[model samples]
Target chain A: MTDRPALSRVRVVLVQASHPGNIGAAARAMKTMGLSSLWLVQPKSFPDAEASARASGATDVLEAAQVVSTLTEALQGVTLAAALTSRRRELSLPAQWSREAAQTLASRAEHGEEVALVFGNETYGLSNEDLRVCQLPVMIPANPAYSSLNLGAAVQVMSYEISMALATPAALPVYGEPLATVDEVEALMAHIERATTATGFFNPANPKRLMPRLRRMFGRIALERDEVNILRGMLNFFERPLPGSAASTIAAPTRDDGKA
Target chain B: MTDRPALSRVRVVLVQASHPGNIGAAARAMKTMGLSSLWLVQPKSFPDAEASARASGATDVLEAAQVVSTLTEALQGVTLAAALTSRRRELSLPAQWSREAAQTLASRAEHGEEVALVFGNETYGLSNEDLRVCQLPVMIPANPAYSSLNLGAAVQVMSYEISMALATPAALPVYGEPLATVDEVEALMAHIERATTATGFFNPANPKRLMPRLRRMFGRIALERDEVNILRGMLNFFERPLPGSAASTIAAPTRDDGKA
Candidate 1:
C-alpha cells in the first residue's frame, strides 16, 4: 500500500526456514519497512495457522509470498544478492557490515535492478555452496561474546537498515517556534551586553573578550524565536531601575558600539 | 562479557508487556547488542517456561532482569530517558528518528550517565502519563500504510541502533592482494601505451586525449597488484608478433613519451 519504488524491487528470501513463526515474523518485519516481496526456499511448512497468527496485520505479505524449491530458483532475476552470515567462511568474500550491504543493495534497486537479501536457517547458517551462489556476504555487528541474534530479529534489523538507506534524508523536527531571525539575534546580543554592563558584571571600559565569547556561545545554541523573546524579557526585568535608587536616572549608555 | 562500556549503562524498560515470548525475545535482542540491564514493570507473566524457551541462549539476561512495580521505580537512576512511540501524540514532544535518538543516548551513556530506552505494551503503547514521564519521544520511521512494528522487533531495531552508535568506526575488510604501487601502475601505463601504439590503435602523430582518458579511467579502478599483473600479461600476449608476416618484423616504437 506504500509507495516505496526501490523497496518494491528488493526481495527478502528465506532459505530452508524450519519454524513457521519465524517466517511469519519476517513477513511482518518486511511489511513494516514497506517491502512486499517475499521468497521462501524449501520451508518445512507453509499455509500453517501458526504463521498466520504470528504475522499479525501483515498476513497479506505472507499470503503473496513465492515458495520455491531451491535458492537458485528463488534468485531468478536478482542482480545483487547478499547472503546474511554471522561469520567469515573459507571461500566466502569478506563479510560486509549490514549497513554498508544495505546501502549497496539500495543503490542497485534504485537504479531498477532486482536485489535479494537472503537469510539461511535458524540453527545452521548458509552452506558453502549457498554462500558461493550469492554475490556478497553480509554480517550484523553484535557482541562478540554472545552473537546469537534470533532469526526474526535479524530480519527486522536488516529490513530496517534497508528502509533507512533507501529513504530520503528527513529534516529534523522543530518542537516550538522557528529559528530566530538574524536581526532578532543581533538585538538579543545588544540587550545582553547592555544588561551585563548595568549589572557591573561586564565593564565596557575593560571589556576583555566577553562579548565575543558570548556571541560564540549563543551561536552554538541556535535559539528559537520564542527562546529569544524569553531571554529579552528576563533582561528587561533586570534592567528596570528601582523607584528610590540613587540617580537610577543615571542612564546606562544605550549603545557602546566601539567597546562592543 | 562484552567490552562495550557505554552499552552497559543502557537499560531496556518494558512497561506492561503482555506476551512472555516477546519479553524473552527482547532480552535476547538486548544481550546480542551488549546491553545487560533489563527492567520489566508489571508484566502479565514472568519466569514462565515459554519465556525461558524463547530466550534461547540469552537466559542469563532474563535471569538478571529486575522486575519493578512501577515505571518510576524502573527509572530511578536514569538521567536521559527516551519513550519509544510509533506516532506523535497530543502533549508529546516532536518525535526524533531512532538513529538520532540513539546517538544522543549513546553520547550521554559514554559520559557515564544512566540512560533508559522505554517501550510500551503490545496492544497499547505508552500511555499519556508514561510518555510525559520520559524526556524525549523516539520513532522508527516506517511504511505509512503499515507501520505496526511488533513489540519484539521494535526492541531489536532500537538495540541495534544503540550498539551501532556506541561502536567505534570499523575499517573495511581487505581482500586477497595489496593495492598496486604507484610505480607498478606507472609501468603498466607505459606498457599499455607501447602495446596500443604497436597495434596501430593510437598513432603518435595525431594522439588526441586517448592516453589521458585511459589514465583517468584506470585511476578510478584502484586495481590490486594481482589485477595489474593480469592486465600486463594480456597486453604482452596481444603485442607478440604473428609467426611470419611481411613487415611484422618492424617493431613498435619503445616509447612515445612526448605524444603520450
Candidate 2:
C-alpha cells in the first residue's frame, strides 16, 4: 500500500458526465483505487438518488466531490493534469501511455505536487479544447476495432495504474549514484575537445561532427559522477604525458586517426 | 485500429446480473473495448427496457448476447479464463494484475486460444466455485478503504486493458540491433584477457577478479556486434607493438592496478 498522504494529492476529474449514476460509480471506482479527491465538471445531476445508490457504500467520495462548471475551473492548482482518451487527435497535446502517465503522476505527487487525471463524457471523449487545457494527454491503448471505454471504467483504469505505481518501486533505481552535473559534463566535453585537438586526433579547423556525436553518446549513457571521472581520466592520459612516459618522445601526429 | 479477428476470439462472461441496466452497460463497455462475445450466466432480467435505454447505441451487443444457465457452458471452448474480483481468498488460484492478465489473454488469443474474462454479480463477487472454474484470478488494486468497483466499471477496465495490450507494441523495441551472441561475447572476453596479459597490465597467475568484473561490465552494456568489434579493436592497440613501441618492451607486472 502507498502512503495515504501521497494518494491524497491525486485528483480524479470527470468532465461533462451525462448520467448521475456514472458519477456515483466513478466515485466508487476512485475510492477503490485510494483516490479521494473527486472533481466533477458540468455534471448533469448531483445529489441524485441514482448516484448514491450506484456508489454502493462509497457515498463519502460523492459527498466530497467538487462540482464545477468548467474543466479549467476543476484543474485549478494542479501541477500536472493528464487527459485520458482513446481517440487520436491531429494537433494533440504531449501524449503518454497510461502506465507512463501514472508513473509520472505518482512521482510528482510523491514530491508534493498536485496531479489530476481527467476523463471525458460517455458519448464523446475530451474535445481538443479540454486536451489543450491539460498538457499531458494519456491514451489507454485499447482494441483498435472498438476503442471506446466507458467514463467510469476509464476512471478505474487510471486509478488502478496510479495505485499500482505507488505500490511498486521504480523499475530502475539509480541507487543514490548522483548523475554528473550539467556543468561537469560540459567541462568534460570541452576538456576532451582540447586534448583531442592538441593530439591532432581532432582537427578543430575542420571539426565536422565529432564533438556533437560525443556529446550525444555521453547524454545517452546518462553518465554518473564516477563515470564522468573515469572518462575524464582517460582523456587526461591523451592530454599530457606522465613522468617517465615512453610515448612522450614521439612527435604529435599531424593526421587524424579517423576514430570517434 | 486492431485486427478484429483476434478480438472475436475473446469472450466476456457476466454471472447472475441483477440489474438489467448494468448488463446493457457492460455490453456497451465490451463493445467499446472491441469485445463482441458476451455470455450472461442466468441474468435476472434481459431484454428489459432499462437495459436497452442504457445501452446507448450498443444494442447490437445486447442483440447478440448469449444467455446461458451455467458457468461451464459459458466457458465452453475457452482455453484461458480470468476471473475478476477484489476479494482475497485463502486457497485462491494464481492471481495477476489486470494489465498482466490482459497481456496473458492477448498473447493466448493471438495463438488462437479462446479467452474468457468473467465478472460476478454486483453485491456478491465470484464464489470459490467460479474462481476454481477460471484458470487465473485478476484483481484490480483499488483503494483499501473503498474497494467496490461496480459491475460495468469492472468490465470496462478489463476490456480496456485487453484492447490496449493488443493495440500497443512491446514497450522496448530492439530496433533491428542484434545483440552480440554469447559465443561472440565470450570471444571478445578471451581476446581482451589475452591482450591485457600481453601488455604486462594483467597478471594471469595472480588475477584478482579484473577479468570477471570486465565481463560483467560488458554484459551490463548489452554490447551490439559493432560495439564489441570496436572495443576489441581498442584492445588490439594494447596487444601488439606499433613501429615505435616503447611500452611493449616492459616485462609483465606482478602487481594489480586496482582498476576494472
Candidate 3:
C-alpha cells in the first residue's frame, strides 16, 4: 500500500530459477514483505504461463522481470551482494546465518547503501560460479533431515529477516545519527594521505608501504562522519595555504582552472 | 556485535496468554525483530517447563516480561491501542483495516508515543473486555477457508507490519554531524507547548479536542532534536508568561488579602 516500504535502494533478485512457479511464489513473497525488484538470471521456465498463474497477486513483478545472461550482469552497480544458499558450497566461504546476514545488510543499508540479496536457482542453489560473484554467502537454517528448502520458502525466510533487521527500533539509537557518508570518509582518507605525504609519514619513495599502515589505522576506527570531519578539519588546518607567507613562486591556478 | 533494530513504541501485550510454549515462541519472534518489552496481563502458565525450550534462544525477552492484572492496567498511559483478531468483532463502529491501524500506531510510535498492541489468549484472539479497551482492531487477511493462524504466526505478521511501516527511504547523513538526543527534544517540546498554550492554539477550555489534532499533526513529522529546537525557537516568538510563575502569582495575591 505504501510503496512496498520505500525500497528505493534495497533490491532482491532470484537467479536461474528452475520452476517458474517458484519464481512466481518468490515474487509474491517479496511483494508481501515490501520487496519487489526481482531479477531473473536465465530462468529456465520464467516469463512462462505457470509463473504468472503461481505469482497469484504479483503478476506485475513477473512480467517486469529482467532476464540477464550472466550473474555478473545481474549484479551490475551492486556494491554488496549476498547470495542465498541452502548449503555451504565446497569452494565457498563460511555461510552467514539469516540474522547475521540481515544485520550485515541492515548496517550497510543504514548508511544509505544500495544492496542486493541474491537467491540462486531452485534445485542447485548457488553454483560455484555464482558463489564466486557473491560478497557473502547466506544460508537459511532448516530441518537438517529435510535441508532442501524450496525457492519461495528460502526467499520468505530471507525477506523476513531483512524486514526484521530494518524494523525501526524503539529504544536508544543503534546507528549513530549522520554516520559518516562514503564520500566524507573517502575525503578524510584522501586528506590523511595528503598530510602523510607532506610529513613523510609515508615515504614517497615507498608510498605503498606507508599507505597500507595508515589504511589499517583508519579501518580500525571505522570512522563515523563527525569523527571523519574532525580528522579532515585537523588536516585542513595544514592543508590551508599557510597565512600570507611563502607564496608559490610559480603562478597559482585559480578556481575553475583547466588544470589536470 | 551490532544492535538489533529498536522495538516499536507499540508495546505487544498478550492477555491471559494460555500456553507457556506459545508465549515463549511469541517472545522469540518479538526479540528477533528487536521488540524487547513484553507485557503479560494475567498470564496463566508463563515461566512453565516448556517455555524455555520453545523460546529457542530469546530468554531475555521472557525474563523481562512485565505481568499486570487487568487489560486496562496493562494499557495504562498508552496513547493508542490495537487488538489483533481473526474473527469478526461485534463493534458498533465499522472495522478498520490492519494497514490503517498499523500506520496509525506507526505514526504515534514515531513521536515516542506510548501504544499497546494487544493479543489475546491462544484459544481466542481477544476477549470482549480486551476488545472494549482497544482503540483499534487489526484483521490479518488470510485464506478465509483455512484461516487458522498460530499465535506466534499472528504476532510475527503483526510485528512485521509495524516494522515495515516504520521502514524509511531517507538517506542517512554521512560522517560530519552530531547525533540528536531525547532530552534536547523534550526541552524543545516543552517550550513549544507553553507558547502554543499562550497563543490560544492550545485552548484551556477545549484542550482535549484541539490537542489531539495538534498531536496528530506533530506525530506525522519525524522531528530530530535540532529541528525540535528550531520549532521551539519559532514558538518563543510569542511573549508567554511562564505557567508556573503565573500560577504562583495568581495564588499569592489572594493568600495575602484573604480572611486569614
In terms of TM-score, the best-performing candidate is: 1
**Candidate 2 local lDDT, residue A85:** 77
lDDT of 2 at A135: 54
TM-score of chain B of 2: 0.64
lDDT of 2 at B20: 93
Candidates' TM-scores? 0.70, 0.63, 0.39
TM-score preference between candidates 2 and 3, better one: 2
RMSD of 3: 22.6
Model 2 CAPRI quality: incorrect
Candidate 1, superposed: residue stretches over 4 Å from native? A169-260, B179-260
**Highest lDDT model number:** 1
Model 3 agreement with the true structure over B162-233: per-residue lDDT tens digits: 655565312322322222333343355456556445434445666543333232223323233344543454
TM-score-best of 1 and 3? 1
Fraction of the real A/B interface contacts present in each candidate?
Answer: 0.42, 0.39, 0.00
Candidate 2 per-residue lDDT, tens place, B126-231, comes to 8778888999999887766677788888888888778777774535212344669999999998886675555444578998766775664466556667556655
Local lDDT at B135 for model 3: 56
> B194, model 2: CA deviation in Å?
61
**Tens-digit lDDT track for model 3 on A1-260?**
23323344567778878878678767766665566678888888767887886566678767777889898988887788998876666778777886689888867866777788898775567778888988989865433323444456556556656755665532311332355776877777677666555544434677654445445435644545655654454455443332322221112444326565
Candidate 3 has what TM-score?
0.39
Best-first order by TM-score: 1, 2, 3
The DockQ-based CAPRI class assigned to model 3 is: incorrect
